[model samples]
Target: MKKDSKSLYYKDYLKLDELLSSQSPRSKELGKEAHDETLFIIVHQVYELWFKLFLHELDFILKLFREKEVDESNIGRGVESLNRILEIQQLSIRQIRLLETMTALNFLEFRDLLFPASGFQSVQFRMIENKLGLDENMRLKYGSSSYKMPLAKPDASEVTKTEKEPSLFKLVEAWLERTPFLEFKNFFFWDQYSEAVNNMLAEDKRHISENPNLSADEKTFHLKEYASTEANFEAILNEDAHHVLVREGHRRLSHKATQAALLIFLYRDHPILHLPFKFLSKLIDLDESLTAWRQQHALLAQRMIGTKIGTGGTTGNVYLSKAAETHKVFTDFANLSTYLIPRSALPDLPENIVKNLGFYYSPESDES
Candidate 1:
């Protein structure tokens, strides 16, 4: 079949025309004298775009979890989305290092033009902090989300400054709340069953169940306390009471599966003992690659401008070091410490590896 003449591509759906022409040079001198100014503009703009996509994908995962869709297929897909977000984050960090290639002199060429401008003012970044479970109320404490834009439209600049983006932490919290623990699921199931039993006992809803408030704890407690008041009536409701008592005996069993599931991710060796083990191992390699990127950024910053405060008024190399600490090579090995050879319990070895030849367990006496 022939394609429709009105068919629109992804770019068409987006307001690309507005975005494409959004960058403005400080001056003809800044644009012409500083050859890399355009590079600076595009790098930050591209980073913002990546952040936007990350927020979108993460929001999708949140909605899926909210709808009680936690089968293997959904979880697999959610993890895939998370992997993509992590990849994009790694790319943004690379772009930050790329800022080092150009001289601060080039940045200084237009530095006076920036006035109070700094990447520290990025609100999208603040939103990311909130998403990651950082205190949202503290954005201004660090100077992010409070800086005003000097050159953009009032509304656009205001939106950029004020809007708090959704984060992964919020998504996970929502997931845990709506997700039924086995205990809750069984309670809900039995509540329905108890209603049916009550109906059976009362031919026309006259004879309510022994515990009319089976679904509610306070009401159940009240009825139990008043049981002696209605001791004679209890005989009439003995069958229904007996049935509920029988179900309560197996209540723990019903909740056991869900409780066990809660333990698997962190308790039973989990992804540490599963396929994510391989992904984490590979990620360790990627960690080295990423650390190389950070080191490269520091070196590049030195090459461009040594020991100088960042244009955004940050202590350049020192600030980057703090950012570098946030990057973990992998997390699977992290949780394993609590379950296995905990880091706190591990004895510190002697400085020389050759001096401590018998550090590891002997194979013959290692296990039961």
Candidate 2:
């Protein structure tokens, strides 16, 4: 055991004096304090603290991805980091429930004092979005102004710099592009997978055509819908077509990255691939959690002040709801399930590749 030269006090260590004194509600400042104002201030302060923790974890994950080759242990660490973020996001959603307990009238007691200082001005939240690679062009604009328009100049500059840096989405896509199991000597996976997909679609068409219960019009409609799904899978099989979708902003993951991701998903049961698969799954989970929090916040705002303009001057619930629906960073990865086939329908990997994708641990090998 090691002992420091000077003993540290608990209050001094966490700076409790500074922290406990930071929450001076505006209603208190106005000489008539409201009961709910303390809760409002504390809730927001807790969120900012959690946001700081998110950035700390994100910095480590980004460092791992920036390396030329990430180790397997590092991938596990990255998954752990994402898992922490997921937990934090769940807390964020739950905090809304706590805020709602203040009631609409309770909120109104101090809400006017918060004029021109809404969640839109939260620089930390904007930083989280930018670092996760929310596309700038796709953002829900407020009266033709940038989302950053509400930020102070210094904070706005930080957001701008973050945008120029490589985001988590781009880094993950690049890492997936460098994945090894997608191709093997004399055994390309995509070609075989494409053939399987065609056969599956053909079987579906046959089933639809032979169904006696379906009217001719219903059958025709189902066939058309089936065709659309087949064409989408076809786009994945064709690199040039995938590129066209990327150009149109309908997709963000590169063709190589998308293929590698699909391969991992299709063969996730392999011992070596399981961790990477979990990492990808965590990304989708993180995105979904954040979206849930955003929607919860929007609904809370609507409940507090029906359709009114935000304290920050934007259309309150409308802006938040639109952002909740559209502001996703891992949408492309989630949509990859559209290309997934059942385990039975998956194309079997070559034997050598299966070995490569497995973590063999025989006694002889371990001794060696």
Candidate 3:
């Protein structure tokens, strides 16, 4: 049979002609082309294309979270979508290695032609950060300049609008705050968790005091460290203390939301809680993976141009390294590990709660 007239052609469907034609090296226009300019342009263009796909998956995940009451059936789908973004980030990091193949000397041939036009002007990258809840205030200053200062007016306007929208971080925190499992009937999670945590800490103190291996100096040091650890724990267990940290900008999650997360973590084995646990874990992974990408990109920049300013006119790797550390958006979820107690130390949840956590079947039918 002849191919149908309506059938998709591989080149037409992917718009390969347009993509292949888009790379016109500035060095080539200047009458002495840098052989590596094509590689440089192509790498960044590929990153932009990947950014487009990343936003698509991220948009779907954000939709699922935007709901007043999240549909449980869609959670796994959201997580799978997030995993795709995570993979893309990994790919983004690996692509830098490919860029590295073009040596610094090769980069120098045409680097000046692109002056004042830096990767800092990448609007799509800014969009991803804004969508993921990177606060503008948290952004490192590029010499008293907003990051958007480099973008064209239209691009800048688009990024500004993203700030008004609820970010993924905001939505997830709200969902955690509203988690129903925190308080049920007589199952006051904080009360039990506090008691367990105190008991666990007291046991720790006993070991440190009684251990024959520790000298008096070591014992004193350990006790002071224990007090510090206990204070850190109190910062979570006490609402007033939690609020104080929030006010100081050291913590972001609300007290109730933090407590809910701690409880879910402690009893993650419960069937109903497993999904939430997975969701939290994925966010942490995504956050860390993205940070790793930023650090790698910074290193790549440093290798390409040491201590010099970026083509975007910023203090190249310095700006990037600071951004990597400060740009992270999911610290609250990652920090929850500090609150995690051993499985043995977790308070036994009520039987009724445990049964409700998973599907249960009755041996006898209700109909007689």
In candidate 1, what are the lDDT values of residues 110-149, reduced to their tens digit? 6567656765556665444444434333222233533233
Better of 1 and 2 by TM-score: 2
Across 95-129, the per-residue lDDT of candidate 2 in tens digits comes to 89998998899888988889888888888888888
Query: Which portions of model 3 miss their true places by more than 4 Å?
Result: 1-5, 211-217, 357-368
- State model 2's lDDT: 0.86
Residues 226-268, candidate 3, lDDT per residue (tens digit)? 9998998988888898999999989988898888888778788
State how far residue 340 of model 3 sits from its true place (Å): 0.9
| Over 4 Å off, model 2 | 1-5, 210-221, 357-368
User: What range of 10 consecutive residues in model 1 has the weakest lDDT sum?
Assistant: 250-259
> Largest TM-score belongs to which candidate?
3
Collision pairs in model 1: 131-167
TM-scores, all candidates, are 0.50, 0.92, 0.93
Q: What is the C-alpha lDDT of each candidate?
A: 0.48, 0.86, 0.86
Task: Please give the lDDT score at residue 210 for candidate 2.
Answer: 98
